[model samples]
Target: MLKAMSGKMCSSSSILQAQKLVDQLQIEACMERFKISLTAADLVRYCQGHRRSDPLITGISSSSNPFKDKKTCVLL
Candidate 1:
């Protein structure tokens, strides 16, 4: 249900799209949490810099040739 709402707002799993939604919600939540209104750009910049606290989010790092001549373990 929530996923549908989120996807309708923008592309699925897009950083910019998700950031836009977060910024919109943050304005209301931030005011209640901090007693002030913060702009979307400011919020986006802050969140990008401190991603450790991000909830229910995962980031991927990939490389075509990540390792050379490395024998990785395999599970039977």
Candidate 2:
């Protein structure tokens, strides 16, 4: 294959190198897109997990009632 650049002849090796660079750029772009998709999925999963585990009853612990554990003290 023959290619002209600025009225200059390009060698086959140079064309091959250019093709390699193009392929590498495409691969990088695909990887970046994949990473973004994975991150979005992870965020959704986290949101669902948090929402699912959220208790409907707020602060129902037995320790919340101070009078429940009251002790009578005898003074000398």
Candidate 3:
């Protein structure tokens, strides 16, 4: 995606394209690669404590993960 956007002028069209690329790359297709499971309480806790984390105080857990998956998993 970055390759497609490289050397392009920073116009409104380019900015919108860049945003779309981010949504598709970093936001949509990140979790299937990791096979991680997350829950609602996890999201609430993260949002509640996001500002509280400092360099030394920040903690990350691979088990009982409290982070939201990047992909949108809609059940339709």
Name the best candidate (by TM-score).
2
C-alpha TM-scores of all predictions: 0.23, 0.37, 0.28
Q: Candidate 1 regions off by >4 Å?
A: 1-38, 59-76
Give the poorly placed runs of model 2, Cα more than 4 Å off.
33-76
Writing each residue's lDDT as its tens digit, candidate 1 over 16-55 gives: 6778999998897867454235666788889888787554
Q: Quantify all predictions' global Cα lDDT against the true fold.
A: 0.63, 0.77, 0.64
The most accurate candidate by lDDT is 2
Please estimate how well model 2 matches the true structure, expressed as its whole-model Cα lDDT. Answer: 0.77
Rank the candidate models, highest TM-score first.
2, 3, 1
Model 3 alpha-carbon miss at residue 64, Å: 54
Clashing pairs in model 2, backbone N/Cα/C closer than 3 A: none
Question: lDDT tens digits, residues 1-76, model 2?
Answer: 7779779999889989989999999998887345878899999898777775554434445666655756678899
| Whole-structure CA lDDT of model 1 | 0.63
Clashes of each: 0, 0, 0
How would you encode candidate 3's per-residue C-alpha lDDT over 1-76 as one tens digit per residue?
3333465546677778878998888866765553235566777677678746643456555554557475688998
Query: By TM-score, how accurate is candidate 3?
Result: 0.28
What stretches of model 3 exceed 4 Å from their correct place? Answer: 1-9, 34-76
